[model samples]
Target: MLRYLRQIEVIGVENQKKLSNSSVLVIGAGGLGSAVITYLACAGVGKIGVSDGDLVEIHNLDRQFIHAGKIGIKKSKSAEMFIKTLNPEVEIEIYDDFGKDKSLRISKYDLVVCCVDTIEDRHKINEVCFKNKKPMIHAAISGFEGELAVFDFRNSGSPCYECIYPRNIHSEKNSVVSPIAGIVGSMQALEAIKLICNFETLNHLLRMDFRYMEFIKISISKRKDCPVCSKNL
Candidate 1:
């Protein structure tokens, strides 16, 4: 409680407790995962599950600060060690894989934060969260550009990840300016905190283009004939 005193002053003790009682799953351990995992732990999220199948590489050092010293370690384990040092009050679980079948476990948490880059994996996460009626925060970055959206499956009517980015659409190769990952990941953590505190966030697509230093929000809607979330309707 002492560590969270300043934050409690702004969000109130009730919201602080809410954060302390929530569980969130972060599915990535790279740039976006580093920031998301760090802030979520410091915010005192009660339980955090980190899943990643990659090992820390030399290149990952640019943005994945959580694995600063251990270059050969698994990302999930590295993140777990950082959380233990950063905030022992927060409990953590580590998963070494992010398979489509493994996505079912996402239902066990209050929220899921998608820090992965592949469209296929995003669709898999969206499917599981929608099926289990859990809200999710989605973030992606590429070349000083990033986008974020909240799929409030808890609402049952909000558009899903697939709704905004169709499966057939091919995304360009992943290329990111290191700082953009931090920017987008921090936004994901902030939005997750807001969600836990019962606050509303952008329901539409929020895009950031650092090259032009411009931000944009575009309204989005669920596809009535779509396959993913329409079944829930």
Candidate 2:
């Protein structure tokens, strides 16, 4: 209680307990994964699963603060180390491969957070979440722009990731502004906590252009023929 005194003040003991009892899976261990994992663990989520098949590199230091000073170490292991250091009471599991083969297990988790950059991986996570009726929070950042969306597959008529990007959209190989990763990733963690605590979320696609100081919430709906989500419908 002492550790979460400030958070308890905002959400109260009951909601905090709800957060502590929930489980979440975060995919990717890059810039976005760094922020998402940090906040969720600190917020007292009971069980956290981190999956990333990358190693910390010298260049990743710009935004992957959780894996700092651990270059050459596997990112999933580094994230587990950081979480254990920040909140030992929070149980964590690490999976280096978070691909379609393992996505089927996502149903066991209360929520899945997509922090990876690739649209293919996001679609994979979305398919699993939709098939298993798990809620998912998705976010991505590129340069000074980022977007976030929450899809509660447990709810009827919710939009899935494929509904927004119906085609294979590849991100340009551009360097992202370091802070934008933190901003967007933190927002992903916030949305997950809100869902666990029964708080309201945008429940729409939120696009942010930090360079222009602009934020827009675009309304989205389920695509009746979405190859990924429609099958579940």
* Residue 35 in model 2: lDDT: 92
Worst 10 residues of 1 by lDDT: 99-108
Which residue pairs does candidate 2 place in steric collision? none
Q: What does candidate 2's lDDT look like per residue over 8-91, in tens digits?
A: 999999999998899999989899999999999999999999999899999999999999899999999999999999999899
Tell me how many residue pairs clash in candidate 2.
0
RMSD per model, one decimal: 1.2, 1.4
Query: Which one is best on lDDT?
Result: 1
Q: What 10-residue stretch in candidate 2 is worst by lDDT? A: 166-175
Candidate 1 ranges with C-alpha deviation above 4 Å: 99-104
RMSD of 1: 1.2
How many steric overlaps are in each model, in order?
A: 1, 0
Which numbered prediction scores highest in TM-score against the true structure?
1
